[model samples]
Target: MRLRILSADERLQEAQGKTTMALFGPSGAGKTTLLKTLPTEETVCLDLEAGLKSVQDWRGDSLPIRRFADAVDIACLIGGANPAAQPDEHFSEAHHAHLRAQHPELAARLDAKRIVFVDSITDLTRQAMAWAKTRPEALSERTGKPDTRGAYGLLAREVIGLLKHLQHAPGRTVIFVGILEKVVDDMNRVSWQPQMEGGKAARELPGIVDQVLTLSLFRQDTDQDGAVSWQHDAEKGHARRLVCQSGNPWGLPAKDRSGKLALTEPADLGALLTKINQTLKG
Candidate 1:
């Protein structure tokens, strides 16, 4: 085997091009409407939740994801194949070729776009979980009784693997949208997390994507010193804010691995992506 080394300039160029972001927020936060902010010509939305009803006036292309196979096959078509995957894996080189040969038009639709938006990974995970329940892992080998643990285990691997494959798609920017759920523990402590079928997905997703952002409402306020700050208040007049990094006062689930974003940005996905790419280039 021959080994090739990348120069420092080459490495920097490779790192600067595209972004993979996970955007989550509560229902009715206009998460779906944000798709309209993206450039219609270069963007394609994978409407997994059929949530495009809110953005009907927006002019852009969309693909519906109704089944588990649709999610996996579309991902493979967009991201191409994973040479490292086994032959049996859906993202394997062999499977990718088969899909391209069979559905050339479907492949072309995604290939023409640079941005791939997966609307609501929560529904995608539900689809995966539903499929997992029918697999051998969901049944006990000895008693043949239903095994929820096995199903959940399989579900985690499938969801995470799909996410990682999409993350590595060359020259493509991918955004995974998810519902953010508010959870109160038995001790009465409240926390917010990405709403997915299993706990593992929420924990693993922040690590997989380049950015984790939460979109929500915040009241514009002024302190005694007349310094402006945004606070989460129900009674005050509120506007949408995108929490881009962690340790924010709202305690939202946010992370910016690129270290290029401000703690808060305007709730515009297109502007945010442009800012990130610009910073990356600099």
Candidate 2:
């Protein structure tokens, strides 16, 4: 290797910027439905939820869904680990190994112009927790009790490692679907965030990706003072909102490294990208 000088224009060509989106919301808020609308071409969704019911009746060609059976299944699919060394005779384990052999590109997803969707980190964390139950180190055999802290730590490490893989994969866009959980402060203020069990992943969701937004169904309501406040309405068929930047009255966790996005927008990536592009133009 040698030190090389490049013009500003030439340096720009080396940039492999990719969009990393973390979308979290309550169930039935259309989180998976929105993901169904993403471009189908070159897209592969890690279907942790195990079905396309969110977009079952929808029209366009549904993207390929890779249903993962467990946390190890996900790890194998993503080529994060080799499962051949694992015990044989287990159908799920063997299936994971077979799938990995079939889809080596998943490990190198960032090099393509594809999008990888990890549908619902909430479920992924659950799977991680389930894995902890199998380990005697994590669960004592004598007492038949599980180590809560150890289980949480494992979940955090698994999720953080997955996030890192997608974040560093330069050319491809990666989207993580998550469920929303609330935390109450001393003042009894309720704040919404990703539902990651056990450890600090709930707090680190925004920091691990290029963007983090919460999808919510909102309703238009007028206050006594004639001011309107958009409140969350779990009932669908109404207003759908995506919170991009944080510190809003809604108190949903969100952030974007690209500061061009509005604080909130409709639940569509096109809208967000348009706003960002328009800002860049200005």
Candidate 3:
């Protein structure tokens, strides 16, 4: 079969495309609440954490992700199929075709939305780990003992595959929200990481997405505390800010692969999307 080459116009048209972002922050930092800032008509939340109570008042459509299979099915439906995957792979062409045929309505619903918001990847990792443990690879053949390490390996592949599939979805903006964890080393050195069952997925997530945003409350001072307060305290300065670019003084985990965002931006997601789109056009 002869390979079809993309013309200059096709390449340039592809360059002006959608974005895939991963938003991370400590719990109670209003990461989920930021969904309210997105256009309700064009956005659909994949509620994996069951933590949409914060945005209960927001009138937007949401699909609850009850299990790991649900996540895989939804991702395949939204992103189509993985052409490079093996025939038997979960997100392979055959599997995706089966899913689309089985659930046409679900696919149609998701097709109408431009933005796919996954509530929390932290929960997705946990569920994936659980599902991985049930697989045959998680057990020692001779000893019949549970292999924790094997399960984690499978969990990482599952999570990364789902994320990459959605990241490549055409004409759609995919946003994955996760928990930011504070870790202390043996020497008392502290570092921030995304909460995941396996280290590999957490470490490689920043590379898989276009933007890595850290949503947190910033104060005038350099003091860092893990707490969320809505009321403004005159004595204690605290305001929610979205850290957009990397290498900031705050040491937050953030990056803009498009090279279009400022060091810091407002917490409003709608405005942020507009800014990113405008930069893409420019």
Candidate 4:
């Protein structure tokens, strides 16, 4: 196969300065809470579980259809939420369009300062599955009907494409929050590991993300007088040490043999970002 090459001018204009980050952890580990602190106008959350509204207190903001086509400097919240009346129904295209229409003046703001957040792609997979079930034609394999897996693939592809586009934008950052799942190791009867839920989508994530951090809770015991000093990762057995660089394609080593990113008390997001920036700069 012959490879086609871009001209000098084309090569010069190609955008190559962008980074993506992924935060993975158990529920209630404060992953989404930590992400809320980043400097952004709006954190576009794709709430797969419909939990964001209750947890984050997000009200609908309207952006006209025309404006959405050219939106910049906007924080986009994209997520699937369960409807109040139906309880089982999740946010769909009609809901998304309604929210977009509420925020009309948002179009002219399309610049690099934008941020996109996908809160829990795992839930999105569930929503996709639910959507697929409603389409009988999509369920026929011989007719090329989409199954739950196919629906999931389509949704994952769309989300990933959106993430890629946002990352390519100058001064833009995209954060993906995923749920941790437990799996038993067949090779070692006593060994177990945690990972994201989606099959192929989860596998493809690490390559695209600039940083992958796993947040865990820790507790500590203190001497006499009941001085209980709490710590993060007390359950993991490493207590005294804080903030260990676990996995880095940039050569940063893990603090211990556990192969997990060790975070210090107070969870220093800035320091983590600094380390990542340095690696990219080098």
Best by TM-score: 1
**Across residues 185-234, which tens digit of lDDT does each residue of candidate 4 receive?**
66653321234334665666665666555555555769799786655442
Better of 2 and 4 by TM-score: 2
Kindly list the per-residue Cα lDDT of model 2 for residues 41-149, writing each as its tens digit: 5556666766568677544333333322344444444433323334552223565557657767654452243566777777777776677556665765567787776
List the candidate numbers ranked by TM-score, top first: 1, 3, 2, 4
For all candidates, the clash counts are: 0, 0, 0, 22
In candidate 3, which residue ranges exceed 4 Å CA deviation?
A: 1-4, 7-9, 15-17, 220-237
lDDT of 1 by residue, 1-282 (tens): 346899987766776667899999888888888888899999999998888999999899999889987899888998888878899987999999999999998888788898888998999999999999999999999999989999999999999999998999988889999999888999998889888998897789999999999988888878899999877752353788889989987789999988989888988889998888777667
At residue 216, candidate 4 shows an lDDT of 59
Error of 1 at 135 (Å): 0.6
1-282: candidate 3 lDDT, tens digit per residue: 446999876754665658899999889889999999999999999999889999889898999987998899899999988888898887899998898899988888899999889988999998898899999989988899999988999998889989999988988899999998878899998677888889999999999999999887766443368553233222343788788888876667999988888787789988988887777665
Candidate 2 residues lying further than 4 Å off, grouped into runs, are 1-17, 57-113, 139-145, 182-188, 219-237, 274-282
Give candidate 4 regions above 4 Å deviation. 1-17, 40-46, 52-104, 108-113, 132-137, 141-149, 152-156, 185-197, 218-266, 278-282
